[model samples]
Target: MIIDITCRTDRFNLSAVGPHFINDCCFGEDFSRWLVGALRRTGVDASVIGMEDFGWSNQATLDGTTYLVCVAGNSDALADNPDRGEWHVMLERKRSLMQRLTGEGKTSATDPLVRRIARVLMEAGLVEVGVEA
Candidate 1:
């Protein structure tokens, strides 16, 4: 079945897209949901980086479709190999740097306390970080 993903361009512009995505991914077929969840706070920053790296703009349009340009790692690429420590570490470093530069502290779409609580649940076997691979 096709997902109901839409080009909610305005939400991304307001830095809300990342937050919105965290929950949508939890139950999706691609079981490596944490990859997307981990990125909840950094998506906006990635978008800005895209502006420099790919000459992507903070704003863009194609064939009358407008979009807020955000750098979400490719789902297809990630789904193939989900748990590489190197990628996690690299992304964390980038996220740290971006936070300092932007002066916009990172808060997961969920609060930090909530994330910790959920982590505990997953660790205790009440939940699982499902592996799509």
Candidate 2:
């Protein structure tokens, strides 16, 4: 199955930090790096893509299965101003039996790394989609 994990940020001041600074120096870079490393440790191939406006995507492959992870902000907000927006962390699983049965699908939530990531995002004040805050 293909899993997509997306992380969205709460509204913040991008003007003070700048998109590049935030992307590289703040949460975005660290989270993406940690995620990729954690997945690799699990024997999965993973990578980060499109690092701009503190929004990016990650790709992972394991056991012939592919997953896409994304960390982005609302398009309208990003287009207008980097700040004054919320971030989204979307986890999407493709072609999975769970998805076939449930429209939303499932992920490696049981995995320690996955859970840790979720918790960290939550601590950072980001909400998980489909999950009660």
Candidate 3:
């Protein structure tokens, strides 16, 4: 499932005129790392896997289920409003070969980590766009 969001960069210590990433990544990269850290702090096993063209790739395991996460979008801070930015967050279950062939293990908003991540973003003050928040 995908969740679109708009947020204030100050919440994540991001600045338009300053460094945008933590470790040689793209605009939204730091935020992705921040999320993984947040999840870890909450006792969730999450980690940043790598960078993606759009943003960053991450992986998280919960209850023996692995989930692939991508937080991507136009994270460019507006020139007139550097604190504001947007993101497209996606999460999917990594299906086994048999499950993939059988068309099972699909993820949705109701999934545990999906709902948890959504709540995390909301609690962090990001506003969900074009969907129920």
- Index of the highest-TM-score prediction: 3
- Tens digits of lDDT, candidate 3, 31-132: 778889878877679999876655678898888888887775553556765545566667778888898888887776667776677667777777753222
The regions of model 3 sitting more than 4 angstroms off are 1-25, 75-77, 129-133
Query: All candidates' lDDT scores?
Result: 0.26, 0.52, 0.65
Worst 10 residues of 1 by lDDT: 1-10
TM-score of each: 0.16, 0.43, 0.75
Q: Tens-digit lDDT track for model 2 on 1-133?
A: 3333344543434334444553532334445666677667657678876465545667766556455666555433455665544454444444566667775544554533345445555655655533322
> lDDT (0-100) at residue 116 of candidate 1?
36
Error of 1 at 132 (Å): 18
lDDT of 2 at 37: 73
> What would the per-residue lDDT of candidate 1 be over residues 1-133, giving only the tens digit for each residue?
0011111111112211233244322112121133234333433222222222211223322233223322222122234344211111011111356766886544332333223323432543432222110
Give Cα distance to truth, residue 81, candidate 2, Å. Answer: 22
Cα lDDT, model 3, residue 15: 46
Tell me the spans in candidate 1 whose CA falls farther than 4 Å from its real position. 1-100, 107-120, 127-133
Tell me which residue pairs clash in candidate 3. none
**Candidates sorted by lDDT, descending order?**
3, 2, 1
